[model samples]
Target chain A: MAEKHNIKNPAVKRILQEVKEMQSNPSDDYMSLPLEENIFEWQFAIRGPRDTEFEGGIYHGRIQLPSEYPFKPPSFMLLTPSGRFETQTKICLSISNHHPEHWQPSWSVRTALVALIAFMPTNPNGALGSLNYKKEDRCALATKSQEAPPKFGTPERQRLIDEIHEYMLSKSSPLPQLAPSQASEEQSKTEEAKAQVNLENPEALPVGAEIPDQAGDRIVEEQELPVNANPNPAGVEASMESSSSVSSNQLLQKSDARVQNLKPDTRVQKPDDRLFTLAAIGLAIAIVVLLLKKFIKSTEYGAVFMDES
Target chain B: MKFCKKYQEYMQGQEKKLPGVGFKKLKKILKKCRRNSSSQKPLHASLAAKTCPDHCPVCDGTFFPSLLNEMSDIVGCFNQRAQKLLELHLASGVRKYFLWIKGKLQGNHTALIQEGKDLVTYALINAIAIRKILKKYDKIHYSKQGQLFKSQIQSMHKEILQSPWLCELMAFHINLRETKVKSRKAHALFDGCSLTFKDGKPALTCELFDSIKVDIDLTCSICLDTVFDPVSLTCGHIFCYICACSAASVSIVNGLKSADPKMKCPLCREGAVYEGAVHLEELNILLSRSCQEYWEQRIQTERVERVKQIKEHWDSQCRAFVGV
Candidate 1:
């Protein structure tokens, strides 16, 4: 019946087209129903944005388009336990009832869904379609919702989401240069440094990486050595000189490459080289220190020979 | 000057031939004659009426025919002397007397002119003077009526304010902020009423008729005459279970069942009356203390009458058997 209706109605045709496009290139944070049956009624699951109380939440709601659709508008009802609005209540919105005149016929289902997701976490007073909830309560709900099973009434709805998720994951290709193991190693080094400083306790490690594990213990030992083993003055001086020289050489190489790329008309290249010049001076200082160390060692050996005589 | 001298000589010769022709009367005749002579010369006279004829002095186009006819009737009512005086007054400077009178007529001062004499004559002369002023003042009158309508609306607002319960309820549940008491009385004044304040705001907003469904029970729950505080439970069961315990004066040591948890719910026999049952709060709130007492008294009287009727029936049957 819906297929027949879609064929007959121009508006249904446009809505179906938009739905197909949205499904083909689905956003990571949004999920929508498929276009097969009952195009007037749709369900969506939206992942909340970061840094908000609703972050990590997968909210579920139903959209009901009026029979005159596109020309009229659609209404929405939230089924999940979102703290902002009462569960299972139809919320009034500008696109719904607050301002029917502003509703444009050209606006698609995807546009409404995007707007609905973006409008979450807004202050509720006088805001059409916005629900008010305590920040703490919302944050708690958001955290709880992360573990909730992605349940839908029909297999079609579930399958649609599964397909979209698969599509998005496929599209998000891993960086070629940064291998998985190398990324983990860099992550672990930062974690070890953080543990040493005790800004956040080491016990609160990433999930699946237990605190008492052998790998965690080795990283902790490495962090401790920087503060402990480098206490000897001569060894510390040699290590510092070598580290400075290596860092300076890296900086000089970066600047040389930048200077080659810079056009003659661009007068700002000198400022870009300031860090490289500082690195060069640091390298020169390290070289001087090494020479001085050598000279001191020779003098000490000479003094030892005279004593022996 | 020569033409004027010739016209004066010609007029003197005519006067001598026709005796007793005074200069003032002759001049009046001459003026009439000149006006008549010009009108008789038909140089596009048919076009005269077509070219802006019957133009309203006030509006500068064809006048509203009905208003002009009415104005002419008013003019006709004036005596010749008053009409002359009005024309003279209009010809001089002022032109707003009629408009002022019209304004005063429509205003609170309307009654004052009705009580005065010869309004039509006075209106006509004054009407011409105040024509422009009247048009301006008519707009003012319209605005004043608009203000009056606004004040009437404000008075309606005050009426709604008097019953904040009805006002708030209508606003919350029905979304109707303003309602007339007369209309409400006409629509919803019935024997039973329901009270519901479900939204947590202190306003009762439920349909009284729809919510009042309860099965009949023989025993009062409170006075146990039949459940006096008949509350419907969540399980869709209603009983005067509380009334029964309170009426029996069962001690706290003796539980609700001691009075009767075995008491069947009037609506559903499967359900039994138990402790900690939820009382339909809306119904309880609506049933006033006095109304409850009246109902209890009425029920007891009806029970006594029923027993008397049964005794009379049995006695008559016994008498008939003895006679046989």
Candidate 2:
């Protein structure tokens, strides 16, 4: 009753309201419930995002609020089989006010939970209160979690879960899903695009066309065949004599336009894609300039000879 | 008249009972009353039962005679000199008995399960006192006990070093001294083999190292990055304190930054960042170093960049004003 008495305090009230908001509009991956009798004590269940080792596994944990309420942070203990956190161990987290100065009382239970869910999948290089398990072990544990019974098997645990489930179900917006497989696919695609752009000038490919190698090979071959066959002695000489000076001037103007657009894209796109695009654009400009330079040099030579004659 | 008045009242109350009772009836009533009273132990007798044994199995005799003899002897030995000797003898016996019991319980094990520094210190003091007494009495030579005492002292020292509170105290000492002299920018520096950046800054979580690499330990992996609002990866790896801020995407509409469904770990090619990431505390020590460095560097870079930008802007303005 004394514990319940403090629930009306501003800090506790704010956290409770936040929890209510989280439940009403549950994140796609996790849900949490505060104890009705004791608002400070909360239980959380998170559904691992699809494609992750913990995908489909539900993790349960306890959040113990400090008696000082929001002034001091809460502590966490995991009760379920999570690959990251050790089962039934209180994990020391920065946001939990375990590290006093780091805690932001403005950060509610929802903030802590959201941060927690998002931090999964990182390498636990120097973390305290983090458990190290083999990938296989983690995956196995995650799979086995489905069959693992809840520790709080009493009416209380069931009621809490039911309440959370109902709340999550009622929510129109789902928690953001961190589907690892999908992310990997997206990452791979970006990487592939980057590799292609790096290897060949992205600017060489006409806008919205396939990469230059795949798109322009047929056109390039067709042009090459005609040039190879047309070794005409007299007609070539006549054309070279007349139009050589004009073509050299046009080549110079085209290269100047390319030089202007060579600046990197400052737009806030994904880092990897942006880098790739920049590299591709640079290469494409370089190739175009080089080709134009050769054409202009040959034309200028012919024009000089015609002037001398 | 007062006595006669009381006698009259007693006689009046006893009027329902026979004044001249039969012997058989009186004897039966007396036996019943005796049996009823004997069923329960008297309070005083029960209290005495604790210290005084009712029967002596060794002598096959009641305790009455021995108790009487002991009481008389105790009274006789009440003189100051005799009482002091008796007290010393009793104390010696108690000490010897305790020592024997402790020896049996401890067997060959000298290690004590000391949960706290205070308890360890107390044990060490007691051991020292015992050693001194043993030597004073010529019960055991100093050489014979020296090694054992030394080992116990060393163990206590090791425990103190291992204790986090003690380490923190030591850090405080170092910090205070260092700050006074102004030797280094920070009190201590944390180093780690790897780093994770959130929002291009470092986040500290020491626990992450425990899970990932056992051999190569780090104080903080994400050093040099200023982790403003730190978040942890599910694997317990902490990153730019604020990096998770964006990854979780806390919004006014969303209430708090919940992990994006599509979030992946920045370090490991595998695993999602948002599924079960937590902020790690142990890594904070390392982050402190990184944060300090990051801020210092940021300031330096920003100053230079600002100057260059201002100069360029002025130059461009001059050119435009001159119609270049």
Candidate 3:
């Protein structure tokens, strides 16, 4: 829950801001969240952007935030079995504090996530911890990423996979929930966490239900905390999904100001749709008028119909 | 020093000329135009008209054509500015290096730092101006053409950063940061694969830049990081030499510029790339000048990589050919 965070420290504050942003308005291609126990250390699962060798892969990774916060850039490591990067090694990138001179203070965790996704398909050249995986091998690993959770992290991280699943399930509507197949994917999402990944796009994310929170820091996910030790799927009162969306929708109305910021295009799109509908109606009315005038002039409708037929 | 002063003034002078299009003003105009058309209740009837109401009220025939010309002018100006900035940096670099060589270097770093600051300011300002111009163009066109325009301007930033002048400026800053650590090895190879001149004198690289503020435009599109050992292809798209070669499927041993007729520019994906890629000499110079240590460390790292690549793929082929 958002209220549980300690927002006193700037590092915590930034981490909370970033986490809350990612949860509500997630990148359609990736999912990342900080652990309830440690805000500084985050667990992330990224869908390799489509049209690349990494396509269809759901990569799990960790982001360790320095206490210095945005002033210091974060380090990123991929944990999934993607052939491009050796699993669990700190990736050498100018954007990743590897070249501090290149780090811009304006960059945030969201920016870094974006950079990471974009940077994956590039030829490794000679970057530290990069691999020149064959295209076939990468595609094979990408397929395996969907079914297998990373073997590296702790069990709690395995639980976080389920959390990532629920987050994806609740946020991206077109995507089918991978949590059901989480058993084969390596763990099961029960009362605590549940998920698997869709290999393809469902067209779009859930349109209006996303709720953006300004981490003054009380944000609530659900009555359920992200991590639950009690793994009884049946005992839960409301279904895991039904409750998550309900809380998200409730928060939607409460944060109307911030919600608009999340979906800026929605406001512009409304007028365009209305204009289109108005134009279509006018065309329909003009055609009807033309038909009536012609029919009346021709006298008998039956005669006109017989001639037309 | 006079030229540096003039370049500084040029940025300040250009500021008002390129005063960017305002977001609020544009939005307000668009809203007013919509309201006027929609006030007649049956909105669709007007919309159904052959002329259609979405046409921009701001641009007439002359205006749209003029905007394109304006876009070119801005791009040309930035390119020219970049060239001038490069000249100033190179001139001063030569002056500093030769003075050091002659042992007459009076150690007045203020002028050097000034030039570096001026270069950053002009590049940044031109980038902003180009973005504004592109955004205005897109808003008027109501299409993704603005993004295309933005990329064109962006390539300039990419080019300017490649200039030998920036490389010198960068080296100056790198030295300032690590005053305590003597550069451990040969000239710092920015991308590590670059061939460094052995026993070459360390040129005038100090006091130009102390702040490591990197422009986003300076980033290599492939690496998503600052461009290093930058080389521009025939298409004018710039990239780190290693990145460019890798993307082109050419090995570092073969080099990007070597005869590879079938090779095409990776970003454009269709344009026939020249057998000879333009070595971003100015940019490489900037890299060697700015941070010799980083450049050197990278060279070491890439040497290991080159060996690995050869061992993994090329070594066996050579052995087979030689019957070893």
* Cα lDDT, all candidates: 0.40, 0.41, 0.51
If scored against the real structure, what TM-score would every candidate get?
A: 0.27, 0.27, 0.35
Put down candidate 3 lDDT per residue, B1-324, tens digits, no spaces. 332333334444542354222334444544554565567436556545523234545433333344445445654554555455445444543363455444346643444443344444444433444445456545533456557545554444333433344443444333333223332122121211121211121122222122223331344554433456777665555666766666666667777666467655545543456464665555565444444454654466457657776676688788889999
Q: State each model's C-alpha RMSD to the native.
A: 48.9, 38.6, 31.9
Clashing residue pairs in all predictions, respectively, total 18, 46, 30
Chain B TM-score by candidate, in order shown: 0.21, 0.23, 0.46
Which sections of candidate 1 miss by over 4 Å? A1-3, A126-130, A149-309, B1-324
Residue B244 displacement (Å), model 2 = 25
True interface contacts reproduced by each model, as a fraction?
0.00, 0.00, 0.00
lDDT (Cα, tens digit) per residue for candidate 1, span A1-309: 223332224234334434433432335566565334566677666665545888656676777776655556677766556676555567766666456555654456777777777677666675544567788889888767555434555885555444433432332222223336977778767765653443223123222221222211211111111342222111111000011123212322221222222222211325656787567667867998999999999999999999999
lDDT ranking, high to low: 3, 2, 1
Q: List model 1 lDDT by residue over B1-324, tens digit each.
A: 332342234334431231111324333433453354346546456334332222223222212223334334333433232333333223321234344445467662222222111222122222322233223323422223223432343333221111212211221212111221222222231222122221111122333222322122223221212233444432333434333233223332353445455443333332344443433322332332223443444456445534564576677778999985
lDDT score, candidate 1:
0.40
Model 2 C-alpha lDDT per residue in residues A136-168, reported as the tens digit of each score = 887887667655435564586666655454433
